[model samples]
Target: MRFFLSVSCFILTFAAAAAAPVIEPPLPMEKAFRMEARRDGPDIALRWQLEDGYYLYREYLSATGDDGKPVEMSTPPGVIKDDPGFGSTEVYYGTATATLVAPTAGMLKVTYQGCQDGGLCYPPTTVDIDPATLAQAMDPAADGPVSPARPQSQAAFPLVSKAAAEPVDGPGIRISDQSANGVVGSLLDRGGVLFLIAGFLGLGVLLAFTPCVFPMYPILAATLSREGESLSAGRGFALSLTYVLSLAAAFSLFGVVAAWWGQSFQVALQSTTATLVVAAIFMALALSSFGLFELQLPSFLRNRVAPARGSGGSLASSAALGFSSALVIGPCVTAPLAGALLYIAQTGDVVLGATALFALGVGKGIPLILMGTFGSGPLPRAGQWMERVRQVFGFLFLATAVWLADGLLPAGTGLLLWSVLAITFAVFIGAFDQMRPEAGGAARLAKSAGLLAGLYGVLLAIGAFSGATDPLKPLAPIAAARSDTTTAKKIIKDSFQSAASAAELSSLLKADANGAPSLVYFTADWCVTCRVIERSVLSDATVANALEGVRLISVDLSKITEANRSLMKELQVIGPPTMLFLDAGNNEVQASRLVGDITTQAVAASAASLKESL
Candidate 1:
C-alpha cells in the first residue's frame, strides 16, 4: 500500500510540473544605452540597443526651454540614416549609434519611450553616461591614458508610481516604430513571393466578372461565332490564344509603366483626373451597349479581317487587339490592377511586374478562351431572350457609369448626377417602349437621350477635374484638419517636462510635480501603423478631447543621429510611435506599448484608463 501511494504522489507531482505555464523575465526595457567620449577626436558616440519589435523616434528632441519649461519638439532637423543591406526584422532588434562633436563633454543625456507587443508600455526613461569610459572600452589598441571613472550619482533614477502617472488618451495604448527593414525583407522572401503570386492570380480571376470585362463577353462571343464553318478548330483555337496573348502583352506593358513611375503615379491615377477619365470611358461603353453608337471596325479595316492563309498574322492581330484592350481596361479594373501595381512598385523590376501582370491576364482570359473553343453552342440562341439579356447588360453598363461618376463628384453632387442619369435612362426606355416599329420617332427620341447623357457625363467630368464639385465627399468634416488653435494650445501646455535620457527618466521618477499626467508619443512618418492610427483614431474628436487634460508630445524618429541610436537602445524602443506616460513631475508611469485597432470606443477606453491611472 505504501509503494502504490508513493507512485501516485510522484505521478501527480510530475503532471503538475508539466502543466505549469512558463514565465519569462520582463523584456529588457526594449532599449539600452552607451555613451563614449574620445579625448583625441573630441567625438562623443551615443549608441542605443533596441530590442526586437520596437523603434526609437529619432527626429524630435525632448528639450527644456530657457525658462526651464518643457518645450515640445514638434519639428527637428536631420534625417535618420539606416543601413540598407541590413534585414528589416534584424534591424528592428539591432542597435543604432550616433556620433556628435562635443565642445567639452560632462555627461550626455538621452531620453526615449518604447512599446511592447503585449500592449503594455514602459514610461519614458533617460540615461546620462560618461563618454570617456565608452571611448576607452571601445578602443582595442589603447595601452595608456585611461580616463578616471566619475562618481555615480547618489540620487537614483526617479520612478513615478503607477498610481501617480496620468492616464493615456485612448482606451488602449500603442508603441510606434519606423524601421522598415524587417517588413521589407519579409515581403521579399520566397514565401512572400509565392503568397503575392497567389494573390495576383485570385484577383485576376475576380476582375473577369467586373463591369470592366463583363461587357466584352457578348462582343467576343459574337466575333468567335462569325468565324464560321470554314475555319478549322485548330485555327479557331489559335485565334483565341492569340487574343489572350495580346491581352497579356498589354497588361505587361502597363505593369512596366506603373513600376517605373512608382507610388506617385499610382496616387495620381486614383486622384480626380483619373477618376473622371474612367467615368468618361464607362459612359461611352454604356452608350455603345445601348446600341446608340456601334463600336465597329472601320471599313478599311475589313482587309485585315479577311481569312488568313496562315494563322500567324491573324493570331498576332488578335493578340495585339487583346493587348490594347488590356490597357484601355486597366483604369477600370482598379482593385486588381492596384494590387499588381503595388507589387510592381515594391519590386522596381520590370520583369517581375510583367510576369505578375501576365499571370493575371492569363487567369482572366482562360474562361473566354475555353468558351470560344466550344463556340456559341454553349450560349442561348439569339431571340426574345437575347434581347432581354442585351437590355440587362445595357442596364449594367449604365450602373457602372453612374458608379464611376460617383467617384468623381462630391456626395451631394454625385447623387444628383446619378439621379439625373437614371431619370434620363427611364425616359428613353419608356419612349422606345411606346413607339411603333414603323415609326422612327422612338429611335430619334432614344438618340436625343443618348446625346443628353453624353453631355451630362462631359459636364460631370469637367466638374470633377476642376474640383468645382465632388460627388463622393463624405457629409461629415474630417476631424484631423480641424484647426482650433485654442484646443491645440491647451493640449500642448498640459504635458510639460524636461527632456532626459533613459537614465534620466529613471532619476526623474523620484521627483514629484503637480499637474495632470502627460503622455509622450514618439513616432515617424515612415511607420505604416503610425499612419493608420493618425488617419483613423488620432483624428477622432473624442480621442483628441481625452488628450485635453493630459500632455501629448510627438517625437519624430526620422532625424535621430547615430549618437541618439545608442540612447534609443537604452530605452528599448524597437520601432516608432512608442507611447510613454508620465506623472505631473515628469516621472514615468503607465505606457501602452502597442498600437491597437483604430476605433472610437477603443480609443476612448484607452483614454479613460490612462486618465484613471493618473
Candidate 2:
C-alpha cells in the first residue's frame, strides 16, 4: 500500500509540473543591443551586437568629437515599418558597425539608441573611447563585468548609463528619416479631426507638467491677482477663455512655421538674446512685485482688467501676454505638438495643424481657467497679507531670473549677484537690527530667517574671491586642501585653482603636454548641471585618485570671446561643463571627452583611461 501511494504521489507531481505555465522571460534589454569598440587604423570603430529580433534606430545613432567623429556610418537597409505617429519609418536590425577616422585626440564618444521588435525602445546610449588603447586590441575578458552579474564588452568608459538622459521632454520625439519626427501624422491619418483634437487636448494637459511650461505660470499668476476680488466666475472664465484662445492661436501657428522651417522653436527660444530678454521681463515683473513701478499698458489693455473701473491694465494685455507666453515661454516639442507639426509638415494643411495646436493650447490653459474662476475665493480680501504674498512672488521672480541667467552670465559675477541679493534680502528682514524681547512673533520669525540668510550670504561673499564657483562649497578650498582621497583633490590644489582669463586660455590649451596627465574643463556660471557634475564627481575621492598628477586647466566660456568662441566651435563643444583629457603628449584623449553633465563613476573611468594612455 505504501509503495502504491508513493507511486501515485510521483505521478501527481509529474502532472502538476507538466501543467505549470512556461513563462518565457520577457525580451532581454541587454541583448537588444550588445556594443563593442575597436580600432580602424588611427580611427575608431564600433560594433553593436544586436539581438535577432531587435533593431537600432539609425537617426539617434551619432558620433561626435575628435577621433570618434563618425565619418560614414551605414545601416543595413531596415524593413520599412509604418508607425502610427511617425508614419513610414525605417529601422535597422541585426548587428552593425560604424567606422570614423580618429581626430588628433580629445574625448571620443559614440551615442546610439535601439528598440526591440516587440515595442520597447532604449534611449540614446553613449560609449567613451580611449584613442590610445584603440591602437591595441581590447581583450573581451579585460573589458570586465559591467556589474558583478552582467559583463559588457563596451562598458569600460560607460557614462551613458550615468543618469538616465533627462527624459526627452515627451513621447512625441520619434526618429524618422534621420530627423526628429512626431507621431501626429499617423494619428491624424487614422483618427480624423475629432480624435486628433481630443488626443492633442490630452497631450496639452500632460505638457502642463513639463519644465518648459513652468515659466508661463508667474505671468498668469501675477496677471490674475488683481481681478480676484471683484470678478465673478463667469467673467473670470470669459477672460480666461479669451486668453486661452489667443494662446492657442499663436502656439499652433508657431508650430506650423517651425515645422515648415525644419527647426525646433524651443531651441530658438533658448538663444542667449531671447533668454536675456525673457530674464529682463521677469526682472521688471519682480520689481513691480516690490511696488517699485506698476505696469501701465495701453488703454486697450487696461480697460479689460477692471472693465467697470477702466483704470488697470486691460484683460487684453493678459490675453496678449498669454499669446506671447504660449509661443515663447512654453516651447517644448511634446508628443501632441510633434504630431500636429508632423501632420502639418507632411501635408501643408494649416487648418489641421492650427486646430491640433489650438486644442493642445486649450488643454494647457485649463489650470488658468480654474485659477481665474475659483482662485480668488481663498484669498484674504485685498489686504496687507496680499502685499506679503506679492513680495514673495518678487523674491521668486528674482530666483527665476538667476536661474535663467545661468549659462548666460559669468559664473563669478552671477555668484556675486546672488550673494548680493541674499545679503540685501537679509538686511530687509532686519537681520542686522537688534530686536527686543517684546518683539511680535512675526518680527521674531523675520529676524530668524534674516539671520540664516545673512550667514549664507557672508559665506557666498567669501567664496567670490576664493576661486570657488559653488555656493555650497564656499569653504571647499579648505576642505580640498585637507582631503586625502582622490588625485583630483591634489590636482585641484596644484593647478586648477589658478584662474585663466579668456585671453590666456587659448595659449594655455596650445601648451604642449608636460609628459604628465592634464585636462581642460570648459565651464560657465550659467551651466547649472555642470555645477552638479563638478561638486559631486569632479571633486570626489575616487576621481581625485584617478586624476592625481594630472594638470587641470579651466576655460571659462562664461565671457564668450573670439578666441574662446572659436576654440569651442573648433572643439565641437557647444556648451559648458565639457571635460577634455590630455595624455603626456598633450594630445586630446578623444574617447574620454566628457560633454555636459557626467557621473562620478565616468570621471574615475576617464581618469583610468587617461592614466592607461600614459
The lDDT per prediction is 0.46, 0.61
Taking the tens digit of each residue's C-alpha lDDT, what string does model 1 give over 1-614?
44336537744753553344421212335222221223324444344455554444453224332344443332222234343322232122244434444434354454554434322234456554444454322333344432233211111111221111232321222222311112222333434444444555666676677555664565455344334444455555566666775776677676667545532222323445555665565566556556687444554554555344322234435554576556334544243454345444433334444656766776777777776666645443445544444454666656655654554444346546654664565555553255556867756676566666655555554444444333333222332246554443222222434333333333334333555565656554333335445655676677778767765655455445443344343343333444555555554444333331235565566567667766
lDDT of 2 at 440: 94
Model 2 segments beyond 4 Å from truth?
1-181, 185-195, 231-245, 300-307, 331-350, 433-443, 468-481, 487-614
- In candidate 1, where is summed lDDT lowest over 10 consecutive residues? 154-163
- Tens-digit lDDT string for candidate 2 (436-555): 989999989898998999888888888876766776777777677789985434234234733334335434544544456567787654445556766677667777777777768877
Cα error, residue 600 of model 2, in Å, equals: 12
Q: Number of the top candidate by TM-score?
A: 2
RMSD of each: 18.3, 18.5
User: lDDT (0-100) at residue 371 of candidate 2?
Assistant: 73
Per-residue error for 526 in candidate 2, Å, reads 8.2
Among the numbered candidates, top lDDT falls to 2
